[model samples]
Target: MKRLLTAALLTLSIAAPNAFAGDTRLELPLQDLIDSPQAKEAGIDGSVRFYLSGQAHPAVVSRMGEDVSNKKTNGVGKSDVESCRWVALSVLKAFQESAKARGANAVVDITSYFKKNEFKSPTNYECYAGNIMSGVALKGTYAKVK
Candidate 1:
């Protein structure tokens, strides 16, 4: 009986090696700051759409939503690099929310204001200022296009 049980277990393991593997979670960095061309081609909704340009559509009804900015003070022992990164993320988040509130699908013409020219990305309009405080600013344009 013991030999039979062992044989059965080994057979199952050999036949289905991945049977014990459940859904695994993997952490990965994502860059979704700009809307993909596929989204534009599919006529994606504005609520879930974001753009790095001033006008989402040239032939659609569009308006300047507003200018939004955010600032964060540096914490103790935090280097300027880290501080600017934190502030830029915070400000961009605020800008996105502000644009959504005003019915803007995307924020365009983004310019970064950073000390000593910090990290650069294809997306975002950032402003880094102040020794104690870092800041970012952006202008959003609300558009409704079919």
Candidate 2:
């Protein structure tokens, strides 16, 4: 019986190697997520503004440090875009709080830092959607801007 079960499992693995792989790459507009009402709900009221990669910002007064946020996916029955935005909101909120804590007024040079890979886009962000979850990762430089 054990041998038969092992043989069946082996066959299944061979038949569908990608059955459990769920990686959907999406690049969605960045401004929409930043402007969403949920940002207010997250307490990100523009006190600590964000500037995406290649976007212009006021002269940086001081560089506090780098910031990163890797939010877990909470996507169930939601579209990839919706799920991505929600996770991105949470990430940005954290950044805002961090900037505030460190006396920084902005986070600039934001980019997608998924899997430690940097994906920079001036107008969009990259998200990975899976079967049961989606994730948004961000990296930025904390700064006190003019």
Off by over 4 Å in 1: 1-61, 113-131, 144-146
Lowest lDDT block of 10, candidate 2? 14-23
Between which residue pairs do clashes occur in model 2? Answer: none
Number of clashes recorded per candidate: 3, 0
TM-score of each: 0.45, 0.84
What tens digits encode model 1's per-residue C-alpha lDDT throughout 1-146?
99999999999888553432212211111123224343334333345334444323334456555464645545336554455455545555666567677776655544343332333334444444343444444344445444
Best by TM-score: 2
State in Å the error of residue 144, model 1. Answer: 4.5
TM-score of 2: 0.84
Question: Can you write out model 2's per-residue Cα lDDT over 101-133, one digit (the tens) per residue?
Answer: 999999999999998999999889889887667
lDDT of 2 at 95: 93
Model 2 lDDT at residue 50: 90
Off by over 4 Å in 2: 1-22
Error of 2 at 89 (Å): 0.5
Best by lDDT: 2
